[model samples]
Every structure is written in C-alpha cells, then in structure tokens.
Target: MTFMKLKFGTAVLLGSLLIGACPALAEAVLHRGNSGEPQTLDPSQTSLEIEAFILKDLYEGLTSYDAAGRIVPGAAESWTVSDDGTVYTFKIHDKANWSDGTPVLAEDFVFSMRRVEDPKTAAGYANILYPIKNAEKVNKGELPVDQLGIKAIDAKTLEITLERPTPFFVELLAHQTALPVNKASFEKNGADFIKPGKLVSNGAFELAEHVQNDHLTAVKNPDYWDAANVKLDKVIFYPSEDQAAAVRRFEAGELQLVYNFSADQIERLRASHGDEVRVTAALSTYFYSFDTRIEPFKDVRVRRALSMAIDRDFLSKEIYSGAQLPAYSLIPLGIATYGEPARPDFADWSQLDREDKAIELMKEAGYGEGGKPLNIEIRYNTNPNHERVAIAVADMWKKTFGANVTLLQNDISAHYAYLKEGGKFNAARAGWTADYADAENFLAINLKKNPVFNYGRYDNPEYDALVEKSYNEKDPAARSKIMHEAEAIVLRDQPIAPMMNFGQLWLVSKKVKGWQDNGSNDHLSKYLSVEE
Candidate 1:
C-alpha cells in the first residue's frame, strides 16, 4: 500500500478504463500497461521500448523473436547467406499480407530501408542499417538513397549486400528498425498515418483504435500470414508513467500486467502475486552521460574522477534494494553469447579504494583542494527509483569530494527529447536496451561518427577504428577482441559513468499465461492467452 503513493505524470489516466467502442466479446483479450506514451509510431524513428511494444504487433520484419526470445523467421520465410557472409537473399512469404489486404512484397522492405537511410527521415536508429553497403553514405547525404545496397529481385525475393561480413545480420532483422512500411500508405497519409485505422500492418495484430496517452487497442490481424496461431483476439495496451497506479490496476483486475515497478513494491508484489510477479536479468545498463565538449568534462581526469567517486555497489544494493547490479563497464556483465566479458580496469576495485582514487584524480584535475569545487548537475526522467538513485549519487559526490550537485527531473517524453537534441547537462541519465543479442548493439551508440544516440559527443578516433575493425573481422574470436578494445577505450575515457545493470520486474495477473522472462524482454501477444 505504501507504494501507492508514487505520483504519476499528468498523462497517466488514474482509473480511466475506457475500452474504445468495440462490442464486448467472449474472445480472449490481454490488457497490458505500457510504461509510457510512444514518441513516434514510425518504426524508423522509434528509439524507445514504449513504441517498440506497439510496433512489434503492427509490423513483422524479415525475422522475429520467438517465445523464448530466439530469432525466427517472420515475414521472410527463409533466407540464404553467401559463403563470404556479405550477401543475403531472402524469400518472402507469399501469404504475408497487410491489414488492408495488400500483398507484402520485397519492394516494401527496399522502400523502408531507403526511408531509414534518407537524411530527411532523421531516424535515430538509422545507423543500424550501416552494415548495408552505402547505407552510411546515403544517410549522411553523401550518396543517393538509391545507392544503398538493398534490392527487390522480384515480388517475393529480396537481396542485400553488406559492407562487411556481419554475423548478426539475420538477428538484426528482428529489430523494429528493420520492419517494412507500406510505401503507398506512408506517402499518401504522410504525418497523419499513425492513427488507428489509417495504419496498415503485416504482423499478428492491427491497430484497432488508439487514444493518446490513454490506451491503444490492437485486434488480431486476419490477414497476417500466421493468424491461425494468434490465440488472443484482442490486446489493449495502456500507457502510464504511474507505476503505483498501474500496480493498483493490476491488483484490481482492471489490468492483466504492469511493467517496471519500483524496487520498494517488488517484495510486496512477490508475496501477493507469487508466480505472477516476474523478475529477469536485463541486457541493459542504466548510466548517466556527460557533455564531454564542456570544460570540466572535457578533461578526462575530471570525468574519471566523477565516475569513480560514486559507490555503485551501495547505490545498487542499498538504494535500489538489490534490484540492479553495480556496473563498471558500459555493457552488462556476463553476456557471453556475443563475446568475452569486457572488464574495465576499475571493475574489481573496492568502494573505499575507488573513492580515495576519485579524490586524488579530482585534486590532479585542479578541483577539491581549495580550488573551485567541481559543480555538477544531473538530469533524469521522472521515476521514483531514478530520483532516489540521483539523490544518492548527488549525496555521494558532495560527501566524498565536496562537489556541488544539482538534480533536475523531466517527464519521460521530454527527458529523451532533451537528451536526443544534445541538450547541455553536466550529467544526464540514459539507458540502452539491446536491439539484438550482441555487444555491438550496446557499443554502437557511442561510435564517434554516430549522430544518433551519442549524447555524450565522445569523439575518439582509436575507439571508432576499433569498432569498425570488429565489424569486418571474419573470425568470431578476433572480432570480439576488437570489440573489447573499443569498449575499453570508452571505459577509460568515461564519457558515460556506468551506474547499474537492470533486471526487468513485472506484475502479472495469475490468469495470464505464456509469459516468459527473457533477456530481451520481448514477450509478444501472439504467445499469450487469458484464462476464462
């Protein structure tokens, strides 16, 4: 009950449960709580999970994730790789059709990929397509969009040429950014196309209706290739920043599932919901980025000092109630599927030793020894747990090195927008969830030439070259070593101070079935069913 006090932003529709105007049916429906309103429905433009939740249902790419989070074929029934691994040829499913009964074709994917590479689109994840030959050039407007290495061989066949051999290219197809859009519908409707009935989809569900900041209703798409396996008749997703209110709704049976509850609520919910209260380790890192172009942060020592000063162990265990792991590296620890663990030099340091070294570094950087005490301000999105962590970090900085600290909070939408725009902040809270099961997904954000998610503006030629080398390395062991070197460069530079690794915590109804706790947090409605 104490967790009920967590305040929500104005967007959270407290107890409002409007289910659109659809007639009540005896069909199965799974009601879920989306963490927040999506910034955009355009798959190319979406950079957040809230948008991904809806887009995953609205569109299927060449491949998709299964219930166990393995990459499986979706729209493209099968694909073949050349001996060199630079070329891929896919066979589109003939039965794949959009919601409006239009046939899904190879041309659709070609158009979508070009759209992402177009500078006019300003897609945040455009760089993800850089593996395709000339994609980076096209995105930078140095080459024509048509030059991008993707072609529609025929209505049912698609061929793509990569700049280099990328082992994860097939798995990358499962990402929302790789989804195809109906070129006709997109051009005709333009900006107004994201609305409910106006959107055309080829996935398991189609947009039935949507109310901004309230709820989005998706009904099973009859035209979907595998619609027969889509057991749920409808799924309604409510977007709310109010974790407590969402939990309350889940308890009252108004909602079937809620996501990302506060650490304080976990124990209580675990006791009450038992098996329905889910927790799974996430391949994500919650960190704060510095504007490295600025004066103090421009100095690597100042950056390193501030990063080493925080007691991440204390913050994770004490403040977050052991809901997270203390992180010293940008990538989460022990994700060995991709490569060897990227261990930072300070990864094994004790809290007291780290703090002492932090002070020494600060003094060397001309601060905290009767010099101007380092002034820092941290900006983060509104969340009870985030606020607590920021406050704890601020306290740590002040106590350890006598640094002045300021805390600023913004709503979820505004917060991401501000960071994306390269807004100035001493340190800004940021997080990265894996788009695919690879270390490259996490490392790509900080690539010096990348304009997308590089909020820190961390420019290092050595780091950039190392990452590029990894992409082209033919051997897995060789590629991983290159990636490790790239990660180490950034870790030493400290453009982003590693905070804590995440574990997704969800409250589900006992009546809901087929939910799996996977690292990707990619549970699709196609696999879920509700009890009568």
Candidate 2:
C-alpha cells in the first residue's frame, strides 16, 4: 500500500500543537461506524462504505448531484442534447485539472468509462453504462472495448452517442463509476494508487493520509473549480465500528459529527442535545434475500410464509426505536419516479392477520406446525444493531410460523465472503443506497442476467423487458406505469422481504455551519464552515 510520511521536525511539531489548541483552526473530525473494511479505493471495483466515503473527496464526474439531488455540472461546464436525444455533447470546464496540475481532457472520461467496463475491472455498476452504444456488447466480450460509444472531439469537448435516448443519462454520469481519472496518474501508480497519497483527485478534497482501521485525513484541494466556496480546510474521518465508541468520541470532544448511532445512544443524545440531532428519512430500504436456487426456500409458499411471519411495524418500533419506517415495497418514499406510488404494496400481508396465514402457508409447503419444524439459519453482519435485529426476527419467525430459526452473525467481511460464494444461508439481510436520482437505479437490480448488484440471482424476463423499455421511454408518466408493473411482478414473487426504510441521524457540532445533509446521503465536509 502507498504511504506518505511527513518530515519529522519542529515545524511539524508546532503545527500539531497549534491544531490541537484551536478547534476552529484545525480539521473537523467526523466519526462513523463502518461495517466492513474498504476492499479497494479503485472507484470502479469497490462499493459499500469505501465508495460512498471516498467519492466525496477523490473524484469528480462530468455531472454531479447537488444538495437538492438535482443534476449539476462538475468537470463539464455545459452540455447539449441533440433534437433526437441520442447525441450528448459536453463542453469541459476550462479550469478542471488533476491534483498534479495535469489538464483533465475528454479522453480521460473515455478511458475511465472503458476501464470500468473492462472484464478485468469487475466493476459492480458496469452494466449501468449499457445504454451507451456498444457498451453491453463490449462488456459481454462480443465487441472490442475501443468500440464503446464515448469519444473525445478534442481536449475540451466530449461527445457521447447512445444506442437509445436516456432521459436520466446526466444523473447517471454523477455516479462514481462515471467519474474521470487521469490516465498518466493511474498508469504511474499501477495498483498502488488505490492506497492513500498515491492517488490523484480533482474533487473538493484530496487524500492526505490514511491509517488502516484508524482514520483517514483529507485536505482541501486548492485547484478545485469551486475552491472559493469550499469552507473546510481539512476533514478527518474515523472509521470506528462501535456505535457506542463513536458516541463516546463525540461526547469527549474528539469528533464534531457522528452518524448511525445505536437506538439507546440516539435516545440518550435526543434527551440531551435534541436540537443538534438531525434526522432525515432516507431513500434506502433494508431487506433479506433468499437464494431461491437453494432447497426448501426454493418453494415460493415458504418464502411468502417467512415474509408474512415477520412484523415490520414491530421491528421498526421495538428494535429500531421508531428510527426507521416500515417498508412494504423496495422503493422508498421521495424517489421521484419509482416512489411509493409506482409500486403495489402487499395489502393482504399484515402484522395482525399474517401469523396464521404464515402457519397455513408453511404447512402447505410440507412443514406442518408442531410437526416436523423447518429449520433455517438467517445471517447478518456482526454489528450490535444487526445482531439485535436478527435475533428479534428469529424469535418472530419461530413464534409465528412454529419453525425453528437460528441467527448467524459474522463480521462484515466474513458475511460478504459468504454472500460472494453463495453459501447456505436461508436468508440474509442487505441494504442498498441509490447511485442516482431515478427509479431505474432501484429496479435495474432485478435484470435477468445482470452479474452485479443482483446478489439474489433473480431472473425474470418480463421484469427485464419492462426495465429496458422504461430506460428508453422519454415520457415520465408512461415509463412510470411500466416500472410499476415490473415492481408488482417482483413483489409478487417475494424473493426478498422488504423490512424498513432508514432514517439517518447525524449529530453536528455547533461549530459546523452551512452544511446540508442532502437526500443523496453524501457528507461533503468541504461545504461546511468552521465558525470563525
């Protein structure tokens, strides 16, 4: 891994002392509980906490989502769409440059997009670019990678021709998979650039230092296009896995911000600093998926019985302490096109009358209540909150369906390993955050042959057809109707049980100002001001 060491001398010592003495003059330290270690810093290959955290500091896309979740220009100053909507021409910003002062040209975008789609990269969202001409064929190795649609007209112009007119193309570019990278920097660092200090960035901040499992420090980028508006001089992120430890760090004045606090800690914090605690209902849903290819769970009735056995409202109120809202559908509220209105909720499945129905369904699936009880193991990460939720779910299943259930908890890394290998867990809990502001972002995961993000390995040709049609449909209302039908098919199958919608809680210190915790769930410390 690449590591940079500062010269050890009195100058460094004096700087440290000054930083410690004046909180406003020093970097703002933000503490958070990440469930797992970052697999890699390569924007194309990594997802989870690392991708979510690093994208804010180390990358810039042609377009970006603003605090209001609207598409805004980043490296690109302006763009034009053809009358037919198949051609997109972007005018690169004259001032954008890498941290090494190299000009960010249109070729960089082409290189980055092609690199993600390369078979060697294994990027999770590579299919996201399939709308671009030849992207799918190139990804499937049917066409050469060079044949991909993206091209550079010159140093300052990028022209993208698509096979179909994509209405959310600009919003999709804001995702990390589409972020530009410097070819020279990437080639020079080779595989080592994924580590700290070796990477080059043109975003609001640049990585200064990183200590494994301890902290990551980012300093403001002086060369950023919006440097004048960036308020923070530096940001320190502590990746503590313990929620209570994060709360203690915040209470001890070591951290200016904390998120994802435990239920008990949130209650205590609300009792004390209620005014400082901010809560926003997220467009995220936590759910459990069954590997239908596996035995027993292969039965649709058994899956529906398991779904009916769990009480979402009870879980939200008791385990989550009302911090979450019960989720009846995969798409959360506030998502524009695929919000709650676009999907059919399970009205017949209810906490009140669902338990007896669950027993009957399980019996019909060849496991009679009080007879040969169906034994199953449910798995989740080893976080305290996750364990508590899993245990509660296990108890609910046992009581309602009269089936024996076991709770299995592993560290985040081990759990992900089990998922990748398609281990024998009957069910597993997972969550997905949006990549862009579209219903397609949520619905695309169910595409029949998609290798990434479809961990359930769900294959439904009808759903896939509807998704493809919706992608090219320019009329919002017409597309939404098709998407609604697709959502109905998925819900009816019950391959996954939608649990709850997240209500993210962030504690910000009084010294921090001008920060808006937007719906995208990104924390851009550069937009925060330390009180003078």
- For each candidate in the order shown, give its overall lDDT on alpha carbons: 0.86, 0.76
Residue 514 lDDT (model 1): 84
- Can you write out model 2's per-residue Cα lDDT over 1-532, one digit (the tens) per residue? 1233344555689888988897667554444334345556677865565445666567888987666555789899999999998899999989998887778889999999999878777677787787789888888888888999999999989999898888878877887778876788789988887667788888888888878777777788888878888877777777656777877777777777776677645677888887667777777878898877776787888888888778888888887788888886877778766556433344455576777777888888887565566888888976677778888888888777666788887766667666755565688987767777677777876666664556667777888898888876878889888888887887777777888888876777666676576777766565566663
Model 1 per-residue lDDT at 364: 88
Instruction: Show model 2 residue runs off by greater than 4 Å.
Output: 1-36, 342-349, 368-372, 420-424
Q: What is the lDDT of candidate 2?
A: 0.76
Please give the RMSD to the true structure for each candidate, in Å.
9.6, 6.1
What TM-score fits each model?
0.93, 0.91
What's the distance in Å from true for residue 124, model 1? 0.9
Give the Cα-based TM-score of candidate 2 against the true structure: 0.91
Best by TM-score: 1
What's the lDDT for residue 318 in model 2? 83
Q: Which residue pairs in candidate 1 have backbone atoms (N, alpha carbon, C) closer than 3 angstroms, thus clashing?
A: none
